[model samples]
Target: MAASGAAVLHRAVRANLTARALALVVVVLVLVISYATSLRIYFAQAHEIATTKAEIAQSQASIADLQSQITRWNDPAYVSAQARERLGWLVPGETGYTVVGADGKPLGGGLTLDSTPTDDPGQPQAMWWDRMWGSVKAADKPAVKKADPGKRAPVTPDSKPR
Candidate 1:
């Protein structure tokens, strides 16, 4: 019976080409599935990385917009307008008029006419590079050292030189 089994196995290995081909195809399919699964994981990670980069770009754009707004608001004319409208300050020779419409509302759009544009030519202009350098230097400077009380001499009232 063992001899018969061996003969049958030999005949299957040597004679049937279609059966061997099917076995090879099944092995290839398993390898392809495994590779495809790994590729899917890699692609998912790439998507996450792309999303993070997009968020970073968006944050940068927002920061740039905010910085631009700060630059504009820091102007002398704009600041003066804001201060006068918000604080109700009146400069000399500047007239204040309120024209109420049919609804009995001021046409100043929540701003008063007493606002003075403080455009002082004598004020020193700030250079962009100087400000940036100063900020960098300030950040690099070491913290202030605390006063050493122990190293200081004891103070006495009405003390004179020896």
Candidate 2:
């Protein structure tokens, strides 16, 4: 009887030890998961902060570039040069000549004007008032739509064919 009682006591102690060890392991696992989540959040925020800072730096650089351009544009010499190059503007009393290619298009190294010459130089352009009156006449007339050759006109049962 004494031996049996000792055996039961030893088993109880082992079971208690195992329960305690399991509880400790569970607590450690929970703590590790919580710490990992916190670290992940911290890293994500750090990355976002770095990206924002980079964007701010890029914007500041662009602003500085625009400011420099503005400074350049404020100069009269730069404005004159831009006008001569871009618009082919000439100083007063100075004659300007444009070299025309065989195709009637102007040939130069400078920036080309957006407005191209008329296809036929001999054809006279209509006066502004004439164009306006023609546009008015056109607008007064109702729009006429042509029927599609591929499609047949719809026939109603009440209508008789002539």
Candidate 3:
């Protein structure tokens, strides 16, 4: 009976040690999982903050560009330049002239007279009166001459016209 009692006491001690070991393992695992979760959250928040800062910088740059454009628009020179380029406006005391090509379209470089005349005189020269008469004749010619429908005769399908 004494030996049996000692065996039972040894088994109880072993069971208690196993339970304590299992509890310790569970606590360690929970600590490891919580630490990993905290690390993930921290990294995510850091990335978000970095992205937000970049967006803010980009927005600030756009705002600066808009402000600069506004300042330029506020200037009289800039406004005049825009009006001259966009609206074909003539400056005060400046004569407005247009050079038209044979196609009845305005010559390129729009109306600004800043072009330097080239010294190349290879082109044929016509008298001023002749050139004026030529332009008058060209302008007199219609761009599209409509066919005189009344001058045409109606034909039947059997006419077999070529």
Candidate 4:
């Protein structure tokens, strides 16, 4: 009986390989799960990169529009238009009439010109010094002495206006 039992134990040991196969399967499943997680992260980063690229393209288009506008403004006609609109510039022997509340449209009795100036009419006119120092910003203005005697009237007791 002891010899038969010993022989059975030896056979059982030779066929006991199920546990090792199960361990290998578990390892393979862990590795697959890790790989899938890494793939998910990579795809997410790709999506973010795409969105950022689209934003960059939009900003570049806006910059291009601004550059075109800047170039257009350098033209003489465009500059003249802006000046006439902003500074009330008119050709010689021409008139500039304002029709406030009309907005370049025909008034259908709801709005009419108030006869008053559309812009600040009573605003104090900028004096010669103010305009020279403010508007005509001649950075390269060389010091010029008054040469003509009449142009530089002397402020003395004997001097008088002509």
Best by TM-score: 2
**Model 4: per-residue Cα lDDT over 1-162, one tens digit each:** 999999889878755666677888999999999999999999999999999999999999999999999999999999888777666677788886755454676433332336766557889667689978865566667569768878876699888766
Per-residue lDDT for 6-111 in model 3, tens only?
Answer: 9999999999999999999999999999999999999999999999999999999999999999999999999998888766898889987778889977886644
Whole-model lDDT values for every prediction = 0.85, 0.93, 0.88, 0.80
What is the number of residue pairs that collide in model 3? Answer: 0
Error of model 2, residue 148, in angstroms: 29
Question: Residue 13 error for model 1, in Å?
Answer: 5.9
Per-candidate total of colliding backbone pairs: 0, 0, 0, 0
Sort the candidates on TM-score, descending order.
2, 1, 3, 4
The reply for model 1, stretches above 4 Å from the true place, is 1-16, 84-89, 111-162
What is the total number of backbone clashes in candidate 2?
A: 0
How well is each residue in 32-72 modelled by candidate 2, as lDDT tens digits?
Answer: 99999999999999999999999999999999999999999
**Span of 10 residues, lowest total lDDT, candidate 2:** 110-119
Which of the predicted structures, 3 or 4, would earn the higher TM-score when compared with the native?
3
Q: Pick by lDDT: which candidate is best? A: 2
Error of 2 at 100 (Å): 1.4
True-vs-predicted CA distance for residue 57, candidate 2, Å: 1.0
Clashing residue pairs in candidate 1 (N, C-alpha, C atoms within 3 angstroms): none
Q: Which residue segments of model 2 deviate by more than 4 Å?
A: 1-6, 109-162
lDDT value for model 3 = 0.88
Clashing pairs in 3: none
